[model samples]
Target: MDLTVLSYVIYLFISIVLTVWVARTLSRAGRVFLAQVFPGSEHLAEAVNHLLVVGFYLVNLGFVSLYLKSGATTETARQVFEGLSVKEGVVLLVLGGMHLGNVFVLNKLRSNSRRDFAVIPPIPPTGFLPEVEA
Candidate 1:
């Protein structure tokens, strides 16, 4: 096969792998954040993590399938960059921006969760209430 074909294949593979890996990492981190925010609800953290990963894969893989290119050229950086269409560049930039925003949001969520956990007290039993009747 030609070098373009090889490069395209490599790029696709790397992009998919990186996106999925980042998604999974974000899921786990989000779980930690949720654990802090929810106090006694650690199970919710795991559930949210799985749900986020599912959504990430669905959206990103859809983009990958739609935007993939098959051929490439061995040329200077300027030539290679110039060959890209405006639409393609915009799509890629949007995807990258989305990923960065996802990370930022997750980090903020984690920080807020830590703060919430720190301020809350443990739950008390319902029966622990004092008897008011004579």
Candidate 2:
């Protein structure tokens, strides 16, 4: 096989493995976060977790497949390494951005939920207190 083919194989393998690992890690750690956001709803959290993971896989895998091609010909081993490094770096950066976006949205939901949880209005008294007898 050509060096370029070898590099492609290695890049695909590494990119996919990294994507799966990151997705699993986020899904596991995000349980507590989802639970908090949807307080008292374990099933909802689990369902949301599944959906998030599926979406993560779709987006990342699509990105990986789309970004798999290297315009530069891989003639040498050093070139392979450089190509792999650039692709992997971009993948990692995109993954991090996705993670941050999820957290930001979830945090916003949690904040809204907390704010809307009040049972009573916080209005002050409209009338003054009557004077007490001496």
lDDT by residue (tens digit), candidate 1, 1-134: 65455545655675677677767777766776667656687787777767767877778777767766634464654443444444345455656776787677667777887775577677877776677998
Per-residue lDDT of model 2, residues 1-134, tens digit only: 99999998998999899989988988998887888878889999999989989999999999999998889999999999999999999999999988888778777877877777856877998999999999
Each prediction's TM-score versus the true structure:
0.56, 0.87
* Per-model lDDT: 0.65, 0.89
Number of clashes in model 1? 0
**Which stretches in model 2 have alpha-carbon errors above 4 Å?**
119-125, 128-134
* CA RMSD of all predictions: 8.1, 5.1
